[model samples]
Target: MAETGEGSRPGYSSAVELRGVGHGKREHAAASPPPPATDAAVLHSSVLDTIGEEITGDALPEGHVLTLEQIRERFGVSRTVARETMRILESMGLVRSRRRVGITVQPRASWNVYDPRVIWWRLSGPGRNAQLRSLTELRIAVEPLAAGAAARSASAAERERAVGIAATLRALGEAGDLDRFLEADIAFHTLLLQASGNEMFGALADVVAVVLQGRTQLGLMPHHPEPAALDLHEAVADAVAGGRPRDAETGMRELLAEVRHAMLPLWEPRTRKG
Candidate 1:
């Protein structure tokens, strides 16, 4: 789910050796037996995630190159651990490993942007505002249509389930229980999309889930959700349950409009920075 991109050019700086990695720790490993496979796996994940974060967060910009030896030395990991990390990264389009070039960060445009972990890294990085706006725009474009389709196509049990989840969402939101609210919120979105019987919309539930969770994780959402937003959710659910496609679409649109309003401040700085 991690991704990377960028290459060395006139304006680009190529980091030959990583800052906290690509260094030495020979004696320590020499003193102890190699770790178990499980420990090795843990080591691999730690190294992978650290490097992944750096790549996506731009700590290691595109065109930066690191060697297997550098990674092993820097992370105090084995050559196998280092190799496997880069291998996974390459698969994610974050980096490319070659015999002579070492591991080179790719361009941003080359990243696996659809991968949720990639989305998380971007959202967790300095470029989060742009990612948030892009994902929300996607949700706005898809969710309303999904809602309408759910109203028309969903089974009776599915429709009732939507209303139930919305009711649960209302209770959790009013109680200021953000954690439960987030799960219920994800459930509501996921169910509606799935019940729409559209495979494409269903697949995007992950995207919507990430956006909802990221909003809470970033402290962007309030301790208590807006009353009107909660009402709109209920309205959408009710419309779906009642089989009113137009009302379902309108209610969903209104709910996302509130989301857009809430995110206005976050997006404002991107405009100014541009």
Candidate 2:
């Protein structure tokens, strides 16, 4: 596991200091009501996100002990907030709390890697390259199969939507609209999985979205997506729309292979370092 960086607990500035007000004004403000109930939820989420990132980034390695008291003290949060954070993390398989032994950070193997939130945290951390590589491999394995299935079995409306998304992807990629391109790219891939009519494959939509966004965020995407890649995407959409299973599979495989090759240089060094 690679340590990304130090994780600091969230904090709030004193309202008086934040406002840079006179003593009388400070006293008045202090007498006012505190923030709304939603602020507490925000605080809980902030603590949960910070601790989750630390664990996934290896800042808090497996077997490290934690406790509600420790979380409350470190983050200046209430015991309720800390307990809720722990409960969320436990549900995500990032930690395990025992009555007497305290909370221990779980091994990475225990994590719900397929969870979109987990994938997002990993992508935002130092281990992003590894996560991207893993996702790419997963996409390579399943996407072509999904494309083939979609071509054979998808409803007409699904096929039409897939084609429309691919067209949008091509337009966005060509215009160097990275944000929209990534969005369209995710939509195209996710639609393929869902249109395949396989429940298991459909559930991977979030996984594909994370991978697509991660690559763009990490600056792994080219300034302009290669013409060949764009062409393959169009080909895949056409084939699926035309109910050509073989062509859909072949085109999707080629597109994925090209993406993998393009990303190899970015991922190889990280692999060696790990």
Most accurate candidate by TM-score: 2
Residue 180: error of model 1 in Å?
A: 2.7
Estimated TM-score for each candidate: 0.78, 0.80
lDDT for every model? 0.76, 0.77
For candidate 1, lDDT tens digit of each residue in 20-103?
011121212211212222223467667876787789886898999999999999999889879888998898899999888799
Worst 10 residues of 1 by lDDT: 10-19
Q: Per-residue lDDT of 140-219 in model 2, one digit per residue for the tens?
A: 99999999999999888878877887788788888999877775677688778878989788777667766775577667
Which residues of candidate 1, in runs, are more than 4 Å off? Answer: 1-40, 271-274
What is the lDDT for 67 in model 1? Answer: 94
